[model samples]
Target: MTDLKRLGLHDLHLSLGGKMVPFAGYEMPVQYAAGVMKEHLHTRAAAGLFDVSHMGQVILRPKGDMASLCAAFEAMMPVDVAGLAQGRQRYGLFTNETGGILDDLMFANRGDHLFVVVNAACKEADVAHMQAHLSAVAEVQPVTDRALLALQGPLAEAALSGLVPQVAVMRFMDVAVVDTVFGALWISRSGYTGEDGFEISVPDGGALGLAQALLARDGVMPIGLGARDSLRLEAGLCLYGHDIDTGTSPVEAGLNWAIQKVRRTGGARAGSFPGDARILAELADGPERQRVALRPDGRAPMREGTAIFAPDGTPVGSVTSGGFGPSVEAPIAMGYVATAYATPGTPLEAEVRGKRLPLTVSTLPFHPTTYKR
Candidate 1:
């Protein structure tokens, strides 16, 4: 096996009792001493810290203004990037010619340039694709000098408010570059756990110190990937390789909102991206299969790859992501089911360990997100 890459906080995580595990080619923390269950609940009731430096970060600088930069990105993404306002962030996907998602990303318009964050597993390929396609339109610079940390949960704002007072005023999806006594912190009011929180981008040298300072605050504790996955599942968020991939289109993945209406077939920037015809068709008519939330009856925990069946025992789909949600306190899952059977409360069965477990099509999220919108 190849060696796992270490993030800047490798040593710090060891010191803080993080149970290191291989993830996305990195030696990441799967759970700390708090364990996945407590870690998951802690984030819901209070706050938890996460080291996400393994994810890719980059800055897109255009030869012209932000409009040109947006146009540069819009060439590959279906999002109406050119229309993004300053300090606002949008979730977008890198789509292939067949309309399948290459990777999902978060990009913020910083007034002068675009700041992007991509899933760690696909970042290498994502960056290479952007460089090959966007070179002529903009400058793509990878940000290796920084470490990313997510402070997630209900009291996250209160914990970090002491260091950065302005953060308390920021609303969901807002981005800002704030200066602290420690140094410059590039922050975004966002997180994956269906909670109000911040993703802080700190210089590599200050990563450990900043994390320590944050953990020092009341209700703040270090969390890990195990809880992160369970949390996102409860939020009905897609995990790049599991819930979405090169074989799934954005519309089929239930991510239509990511594409602004202005970029649709009749809109201002229509037909400007890969798989435009097919994607627009699916958007108009709806895809045959749609990703939806599934709540398994009882406590069997319908895991991924489990076959989903109709009342008559015909296979209609398979679970893409599944697990027990600590916050929801039940077995929750998300998968692509035939559109006819995708409505909420639709009865279905999930084949788990050779037994047919009852399930229902439920509206996401299993738990409502408490973003400060």
Candidate 2:
């Protein structure tokens, strides 16, 4: 644990009775004194502050023109980078030559440059990938002097707006750099908890102060990674390395919505990025298996690696992400199954502890998302 990196709020988490554990090379808090169940419920009802600083923060500065930079970036992935408007953010994926996902990320078109956020474990490789590919048109700059914090829930807007009144006007996916006493806050109206919230990047020096101020609010509580995982799972969002990875394609992972039509086979700018052949083919002709939402019959949670079986005892797929959804009050899961069984209400069985347990394919998002659109 000594070799693991620590966030700026490490001491603050310890003070709040957070149970520290290793995650993505960081010694992060998995749960606080309130436990994962209470923390999960509290965030759905109120606001939960999360320390997500371990995730990578990066900037892509254009050398010539924004259009050229976007073009250069588009060469790496099958996304419509040029179509993104300023002051807005969108979900993105880094794909390998074989059309498999290297990582999933969020990028914001910040007028002059792009602000990108990648998962903690893939930061180094992601930065290197960008530099290796976009060096001619953009400067890949890694931001290391900031801490990222997420304030998420129904009350997030009320709590955050109390300190920074300007943030109240921001809608979902809106990104802005607001000046505050704590310093310039690069804020995005988005989060992974399927709630209305903001992801704020504050200077390292002001990280603790801003966290303390937010925690001082009436409904804000300190949340840890345990609750974070459950919250995202309930939302039906994919976690990198688990639900999505280098072996999975965006089309197969049920992320076709993220790829705008412009990049499709018949669209204006079609078939130029890496793995375009395979990705576009998958788009035209459906994939063999697709990611789907799963609901276990009883209270027992079917964890990851649980294999799926057909009605006649034929092997199908396996669970990628699964857990007891605190909000849904039932064990929920997400996995890839034969496209034939991906429909809603399709009966199936999960091999949990070597016994076939009944389950069903359900629509995504075990719980409804309350984003402020």
Candidate 3:
């Protein structure tokens, strides 16, 4: 097997009892001694810190300024890049010519330039794609030496205020640069766990120190990827390559809100991106199959790739990501099924061991989001 990369906080994770495992070509912590269940609950009740350095962070700068940069960048994707205001972040996707997703990402407007965060698994391909199409107009630079950390949960604001007091005044999706003893940390009021939190980008040399400082604070604990997955699942967020992929469209994934009015069918920047024809068509007419949340009444958690069937044994769809939600207190999953069967309270079955288990489709965000906005 090929060697795995270590995150900047790898040693800190070990010292804090993270059970390390390989994920996204990195040696990541799957869980700590408290385990996935407890960690999941603690994050809900208090603050939890996560080392998400494996994810990609990049900066896009134009030859001149932000005016034409947004237009040029907008030509490459379906989002309203020009509409993204200063210090604000928006979720976007790189769409292929045929309406498939290249990768889903979050981009923030930083006054002078754009800051982008993408999945670790797709960062290389994503950067290559940008370089191929955007090289002539803008500089696509990767921030390879920084480390990203997520401080999430209800208590996240209070816990973080001690270090960066001004962050408490910021709303969700707000980005800023805060100076600390270590260095100027690029901090954002955002996170993946359906809570009001921050994703802090610290210098590589100070990642361990920042992580250790946060861990020493009350109500803050080191959470691993295991809890992170379950939290996002509960938040009804998609995990690239699992809940969504190159085969999926933004419409099929129920991400219509991510597409703004300015870029839709008849608007000014309409039909500018790769798959606007199909995406707009899907917007007018719903997709054949749509991603839905499933609630299995039993305790056993069904995993990804589990087949779904109707009560009469006709197969409907399959599970993409499934697990026991420590907060939901039941087995929950997100998957695609026939549009007709993708309604709340609609009954379906999932084949677990040999027999089929019963389930019902439910609305997303199994847990409510508590963003400060």
- The most accurate candidate by TM-score is 2
The alpha-carbon deviation from the true structure for residue 270 of candidate 2, after best TM-score superposition, in angstroms, is: 1.3
- Cα lDDT tens digits for candidate 2, 1-373: 9999998899999999999999999999999999999999999999999999999999999999999999988888889999999999999999999999988999999999999999999999999999999999999999999999999999999999999998999999999999898899999999999999999999999899999999999899999999999999999999999999998899999999998999998889987988998999999999989999999987779999999998899899999999999999989999999998899999999988878899999998899999999
What is the C-alpha local distance difference test score of each model?
0.92, 0.95, 0.91
lDDT per residue (tens digit) for residues 251-365 in model 3 = 9999989889888988887878988889999999999889999999677788999999988888899999999999998889999998989989999999999878888999999
The TM-score of candidate 3 is 0.98
RMSD, each candidate, Å? 1.1, 0.7, 1.1
Candidate 1 lDDT tens digits, 21-70: 99999999999887999999999999999999999999988877667668
Candidate 3, pairs of clashing residues: none
Ranking of models by lDDT: 2, 1, 3
Model with the higher TM-score, candidate 1 or 2: 2
Instruction: Report the C-alpha displacement of residue 265, candidate 1, in angstroms.
Output: 2.1
Scanning candidate 2 in windows of ten residues, the lowest lDDT window is: 265-274
User: What lDDT is reached at residue 306 by model 1?
Assistant: 92
Root-mean-square deviation of candidate 2: 0.7
Better of 2 and 3 by TM-score: 2
